[model samples]
Target: MTRPGFSAVSVLGVCLLFTLSGCSGTPAPAPTTGSASATATATATASPSPTAPTSQAVTPSPTATAPPSSAPPSSAPAGPTETATPTAEPTFTGFPEQTGPLTIYYVAIGDNGVSGPMIGCGDSIVATTTAPVRFTDQVGPSLGTLLVNKSRDVGLSGLVNVLYQSNLTYVGGELVGSTINIYLSGQFMLGGVCDIPRAKAQLEYTAMAASGATSAQVFVDGRPIDEVLSLK
Candidate 1:
């Protein structure tokens, strides 16, 4: 009643199992290596760190440059330039109390020279022995008024009004025949003229008049000259 050593049922079951395994054509899956897994884990961790490092910020140092100066502004210059100095005038000697008696002659010459008895340099009278004196106007206006035309005369006929004066020059103290001179000025109001210096001619003497006339008067140099010629 026991089955033979190789039972057909058992054998048929074993062959069927082998046939299914061959027809499925499946192989065993390979096991994962430890090194490969470790490499993969490192790569994943490094990739995530790339996005994280960009978060921090950087700064600069202290002690840079300095500022500008604190000084004030400037000022201006001062005043104008200056000029030069001036000059002075002239001088002469003094005079006497009275002039003594003297006789003078009048002479006629051509057109220009001294004319009657004139006083100059001192107290005496000096005679002009020439005709019409060509005189210089020394004061007032530079060129002055002419009282008379250039003409012939025995006496000085022009009248002069002294409007101003130069410094007084001294004619010496009077004696029997003291002589003197002067420089006068003139400007013509009535006529056109040039200036003349101590130019008028007259006779002067210290003799008392016989006609009860205290002062003497004479017609000379074409003018009536009234002069105190005496000490009476």
Candidate 2:
């Protein structure tokens, strides 16, 4: 039973077990090289996140620029900038009284440069009035209305109702034989003889009657009245 061959067999079995254990040792975890590769991949993923931040940073730039673009459109509505033209004089000059047996005849606007009827007002001068009536005096304080009222018997309307102030003034007169030169300053009315030839006829007749002149030459602002008015 105690054979010497038994110890030799036990020793052979022990050597076979040691060889199998060495072979199944998990190959030293493959030198842990795959873990290092996984870690590198994770680092690459983190690097790509930095690119995402760059993209995110650029997104805000467009948002900030959007407000500026919209702001210019808001200012576009401020367009209709125009200045108003002045149509009135600052201060009008004073009017003087009528001088020496002078008569001012008012001609209402009508057809053919002379209306249906004419109004001639004569005032006897105890002391000679100032030559040439002033704009203020001519249209002063309802004077035009009173003048219009005097011509009511002739069935004339809208003669004295000048809606706008006629920045007009009568200066001195120059008499050349039967032809008397009448001078006026500034504009008389918006219309002229061309528009209302009757009005011109009225004025001419009145001037001739007042100066006792056979003919009258009209001058406005030192220019011929014909030039200012489109006389027909």
Candidate 3:
């Protein structure tokens, strides 16, 4: 009897087909076309991208700079500065020379005429010559020229000398510092009271002028001229 569905040979043939299919390599699954395709898309989206060699961004360091100076810039043109000049000193010279004709003082009557006191007599100037290096040496000779009694003897007229017959002699004259000292040996004779001052004026004026000094002291016979003149 035959089965209702398949014959025995057919059934065995079907079994053999299944066995061979199983022995073969596993069959590729059919291309997903619905829910499986969706599942594969989700897995691909969840995976991380192949980072492109992961190039690290290198940050460069900042450049250094110098700070600004506080000083202001100069506007003037550059050049050499001027310096001050020194002053020169003055030159030195020597002392002055003293040489010339000497002056002598003699007695002369005043405008009041000869009737006036000899004390009121004026002075007359006379010139004499002597070769002397110093004023002291010139004084003696100048005084000697003055001792003459008459003014006419010295080439002058109208002038009188109270020492006419006085016989006063010039001994010497000396200058110590600024002072003038005169020595004489004589007999002072005054004819009248006025003759005293006349004699003093003649001797003192002549000595002072010759010595170029302001004052002079006269000595007669080692006595002061004041004492000798006063005795007259």
Instruction: Name the top lDDT candidate.
Output: 3
Sort all candidates by TM-score, best to worst: 3, 2, 1
lDDT of each: 0.32, 0.49, 0.68
Give all TM-scores, in the order shown: 0.15, 0.34, 0.45
Could you tell me the TM-score of candidate 2?
0.34
Kindly report which residue stretches of model 2 are placed more than 4 angstroms away from their true locations once superposed: 1-102, 108-165, 191-196
70-137 per-residue lDDT for model 1 (tens digits): 43333543334446566565553433233232222222222134443333322222332222223222
Best-first order by lDDT: 3, 2, 1
Candidate 1 TM-score to native = 0.15
Off by over 4 Å in 1: 1-12, 19-33, 41-50, 61-232
What range of 10 consecutive residues in model 3 has the weakest lDDT sum?
A: 121-130
Taking the tens digit of each residue's C-alpha lDDT, what string does model 2 give over 1-232?
A: 8665657779999999999999987765454788989988999988865433344444344434443332235545556657999888778454456434333333343322343343222211111122344342332222232223323233333343221334555565666999977776767554432333433444455566555578877777888877776544
> Candidate 2, clashing residue pairs?
98-129, 99-129, 113-197, 113-198, 114-198
Record all residue pairs in model 3 with backbone atoms less than 3 Å apart, i.e. clashing.
none
